[model samples]
Target: MGHAICEELEAHGENFIVIDKNESRTETLRDEKFDASVGDISHKDLIEKISMPPTIFVVSSDILANISFTERVRKQYPNVTIFARAADESTKEELVKKGANHVILSQEIVSNVVYDKIKKLEDSADAQKLLRVLKETEEKLAIIVHDNPDPDALASALALKYIGNGVNVESDILYGRGIGHQENRSFVNLLDIELKKIEDTDLNRYNKYAFIDTVPDANNSASVTPNIIIDHHEVTESIPDADFVLIDANCGSTAAIMTKFIRELNVDIPKEIASALLYGIRSDTQDFTRNTSPADLTAAAYLYPHVNYELLKQITSSVISVGTLNVLGDAIKNRKMRGSYLLSNVGFIRDSDTLSQAADYLLRLEGVTTAVVYGIIEDSGIYISARTKDIRVSMGEVLKEAFKDVGSAGGHNGMAAAQIPLGIFDSVKDKDSLIYLCEEAVTKRFLAVVGAEDEK
Candidate 1:
């Protein structure tokens, strides 16, 4: 396992040093051109020779040895991140107390993967039906990703395009509002993904329109009527009559659903496609920390070995722009709190999608369970992004009820967004007055719907 970690780190061009007491193992690693040392990691002298703040992976099978080594490293470095392997829950707890920053339980991860595979076997039947539907479509097709698309949306679109290409049905991937997330931009630019903007596209040119990761007639996608809808979000609104529709709200990410289709069809998945799908699942599931299902795990495990690890590393580590940081700073300073809820208005933002980024960051606060971040775009009106971990209330449904009368809003249960036209508040010319009115209206409406507003 230590060797595997070293190989992965080296694969991503990350500078790392491997320490082992066994001379043979150290020698083998050195022969493989890796930085290696034959010394006890628990030794203070050896630890002092190394760099500070390094991420240490303790993969020894010996539970006591692992715990002892972690404790020693914690005492010496004090700030190094340690990932220790655990045999069971008790061992995991012990390692944590001994200063393991993260406990990687092999049994738990394996059992989850096994359960996912069993469930995936059942999902394959649906994938075959989906493939037949794709084969039924003749010639040209347009795959529409949700507006301001994320990794899950974009990857699902790519998977559909791959299936379409197999059926000899030429297809083009289209997105409305363009891609704005920095990581998303890197994914597309690095992978050379071709996406046509809806504004420049003619809907009449395609024989079939399929929406991936978005529901039909939801105000968040292309204006064209879709013949097919494949999504993983809860079906809240009435859907359009389409030739094919596959929506499993229980699935963690749309990428998982599309991955099933790709694997079931037994087609060759390009390296970039596999990496994109893997990233999509990880991003949407927050690295399997939230809203993850067995199918999601199975899809991710299946794609893991085939993914371009280097590219995935690069995409995930993409740098954030100064503009996004500024928006986040404003959001932090101006945030309002009501119980577990947090709302922030980032006065003005050039890219509306930055609101989502801010919301994600704010939700990480110690006591916050829900976060809503909004910013005014010059001519685009108020763009609001909401995220919640509280399962008692669905954020998407909340947004739909709050702003549906005056704006367009709807998304998955956990993550949702709304866009209100600037015309409604056009009467207020003063920038501060416009922001205040907008914030007051949105906060009241949202709080009332969520039953979070202060009672009179």
Candidate 2:
């Protein structure tokens, strides 16, 4: 087992030394061009003579020898990282207590390999199921995304449409509300992804409907029952029944799930599709800084080589629009700070997406650990965008607990948003009074949930 590990390390071009108690075994390793020495690993004289690197690995056949070597090395070099092999759980625990930074168990490694294989098989089955459903579509298919669709939603919808095309089922990407973010608009225009407004499209023409990146809900304007639903958000409300539903809260983005399907089904990924999916994963995961998983990283890695870097740069570096700048100005001027929390009112705005940008910007303030920006739309309701770096707080839960009775709210731990219908607030004609009431109500509700209300 240790020889196999050494071969792998050598194949990866890593520098490592081997120690063995048997002189013939050490000579054999040296003859094979390995840095080998015949010495007892637990001997203080042997350890003192050898130059120790920042990391040491003790993977002998004997668990007792491994533990002794780990303890001796830790006592001599307290700062070095030690990886020790163990025979069982008890030996693993003993190695850890003796200051082994990592314990590698063959059984655990085998179990992980088995789990990965099973997961791959399950994913393949899911892909086949989705393809079967797409092939059954009589007329055209409608791949609808959430309102004001972001890159993740757009990419996933496009991936589904690509898959649908493979089975000769024509599909259209549909979205409710306008894409208000500058970067989102650039992504669509640059990629030449065709999308139709849900209000403008004839819903009756499509025989099959697939919702991507969002489930059927009151806010999404999903009038008809969906045949399919694929999403990554935590399911707050019970999902409406669908023929094929793949909702993985563990995934960082819906694009990652779609990437898995494309790979499992052996569909050739186009460069444009790869670029879009990679950007979708990056955007939704905040470049893997928030709510990311190994699946998301693996998906990104697979898509990276095929992505168009030039187009990606253009989409990500889109200039802020005049409306967004105006909103940011308002947010900065009206900022209110209480302890580590900062709240700002951007006043009435046509674009709600700018609120999140402003919240992200406000979170960079020196002392602020949590930032919230809110605004009201004319016919719509008050929109709230929140961001937090405090690991103790879940922004999603905070927003949900604060406004569950009055509106809809949910997201990841670090970022969340909410929308409350303008019920009684619509009657307030005075702009100043409306801003005051919105600020007071929003601040009190939000701060109360985070337990920062008592702070002056």
Candidate 3:
């Protein structure tokens, strides 16, 4: 196993050292022009003899030996990454518990390699289809993002623009609504991305339209037919009848799918663009905490070195307003727990985006796996934002089924929102009445939809 690993690393032109207790193995590695040492890796003195600690220590010996070596390394140099090979589930767990950064089962690795090869072939075919679309189009195209575009939507749009530029096809990134959240605004400003409001732009000026991060039937998307739809959201509703649809719900983020395009096209990703795409993937996947897939991690890895770390720091660390903080406090104070689900009403808020933020915060409460926060937005309407860690619940479908008759609603499985126009509750007399009406209507409808046992 050690010899095979050394050979593979050498094939990739990577510098590595081999440490083995067996003289013959050490001699064999040395014969192959590799740095070899004969010693027990678990010995502190033996490891210290190596000039410098490696960035990654590969443990390919038997499970017991690997675990022993990993534990020893972690004790001395806790920061060093350990990649250990395990023969079975028991050994895998032991290696992981002993501080292996990654534990690989030989069988699983072999199977995954085969699966990846097949996936690559399929990706190549799709890349050809994408190139055909770009090359065949003679006129300019419009890439429309969902309303109140977030980092994921904006970054995906930017990536598509890059792809369009590579093919010599002109494209403009457009959004149906303005960015409202503090983080989103910071992302756009820091990245220097230009997104035109679709309402202001003349749609007819563009010969074809494309949708990124959202489909035509989405409540947040503009009411326009698209020639291409590239999104990572689930197929919960009717998709846009685009000439080419590249929807991969398994990717976790639209940016992941767009990043794949950038790589397949062999186009250079600028530092600004790389930073934006990395931020998009992190934001959409909640830093790989919510609904993340392997592809999302892979895309993030690809963009890591090229990204502008300083700009990403600024974008993520942007300050939130006192109003948003107050709303979050109010949501927490008014929260009612039902099983693992918590529901709250913030009374009133001018920025409806605050509801989503509050819902996300409430979901972190102990014992609460799902949270629904609602508030009345001044002049606009009543808005409901829901978030869930429970895989059984599809937040988007829940919101749709709860209030589809009264308002526009839809989102991903883990997060969703709904809006009901104030005109629907015309019977309200005063501020107190309006608040009570909103609370009653929203709570009853949401609880009914989610089928919670009780609300307290």
Candidate 4:
């Protein structure tokens, strides 16, 4: 895997050195580009042999085993950037304890792919023209999320707010249901993140509106004519008016990318805002140890001195919001299994992040290599989040297959999220068919991608 990354980087003209257990792979890359060496990445001797300190050092191998390896590299080359990968978000969190500059996950790779594709499409004349439509309004912008909010959604939204604010363009974040999620409530109380009611936000007031962590027209989003978009999730439709789109499958959090823009502009991030933004980066990337980039690390370090630690603690440990438990209960009770996957049915939900959290916890079960959690967050909208150990089978592709006809979908290598709008089919309407359909769709897709199953 390290060789593969080195190979890919070399293709892009990066001068890197590869140290691997399989010595032959190193020689193979000699013909491609970059330098190579053989030996355990954890060995001290191999560490000394790496003379050229790379700007980006990707920890693509096992997390626990690579911790010391990354530490040694960082200790030797403090300025070098480390891009690490974790098996799960929690594992990613654990990796952060090792002081990694940045951690990326397989799931995030999907986000990168999405962004790369968008970068290509954005060059087209038609796409460029549509982006202009979003710019029609020059001074003000409005940003929206789904009905309720989660850390990823909130952080992503806040990131855009900062970006809009940086350009001296007034952006009013419009949404409701900041009511649920204790952590959310605490974050609200501590940071006072501004928001505007969707109804109150006059599209006329803002020249353009951009959506974060959401692809308009696909989910239960009230607005889809977004002129600008910055998201980490998968989407099928091209945002109609977005002049510039930064959607990537490689990044874990939009905050991870949002921080990049903040750095680029050399803007001074307020301490409180830095705290919120840092927490957003920590929470989404699981602290630069998972689903991260060199940019995320740079942003984190830049924001570290500016963050309010006490406020961050308050928000992370805040009391659960009212009715949030009921939403979680539904996710647990309906949980079942398909192969090593714990398939849970969150019948109806209010928060999309809760459904994702439930799926995240389910992956910790013994003998399970993967877990799939699904639920509806009101109306006919069914939301899904998936996790897996198979690094080869990207959940993004899996999600696209599962939600092809049901809805638009995509994700990174290990984790993916999809929302199916069954509003068209009333029979499947209020029925328990959401989970059933999800299971069937996911199963068929999984079987096709992975030839054999249950080997573990």
Q: Which tens-of-lDDT digit does each residue in 1-456 have in candidate 2?
A: 667766766764557898889899888899989998887876768787899886666877788988988898889888677778899999999999999877888665443343344366568768988999999999999998877788999999999999999999999999887788899999999999998988998899999899898878634666988999998888777888888999888899999999999999998999999999999999999999989988899999999999999999999899999999999999999998999999999889998889988998899989999999999987778989999999998898899899988887878788888888888686788888987898888999998888888996
lDDT (tens digit, per residue) of candidate 4 on 313-349: 8787776544656656665777666566667766666
lDDT of 3 by residue, 293-397 (tens): 888999999999899889999998999988789999999899988788898988877777788899888888889999999988666688888999899889988
Candidate 4: TM-score? 0.63
Q: Which has the greatest TM-score?
A: 2
Top-lDDT structure, candidate number:
2
Q: Per-prediction TM-score, please? A: 0.72, 0.75, 0.72, 0.63
Candidate 2 regions exceeding 4 Å error are 1-109
1-456 per-residue lDDT for model 1 (tens digits): 676667666654556777788999889999999888787755657656766544677777777788888888898777566778889999999999999867878764443343334334445656666677678777689898876888999899998888888878788998777677799999899888899988888878887889999875564557777788999887767888887788887788999988888888788889999999999999998999878988899899899988999999999999998988999999999999999999998887888778989999999999999999998887778889999989887888899899878987877778888888899987788999988988998899999999889932
TM-score of 1: 0.72
Give the clash count for each candidate: 0, 0, 0, 25
Q: How far in Å is the alpha carbon of 168 misplaced in model 2? A: 1.3
- Minimum summed lDDT over a 10-residue window in model 2 is located at 109-118
Scanning candidate 4 in windows of ten residues, the lowest lDDT window is 118-127
Q: Model 4 residue 376 lDDT?
A: 61
Q: lDDT rank, highest first?
A: 2, 1, 3, 4
The candidate 3 region of ten consecutive residues with least summed lDDT is 110-119
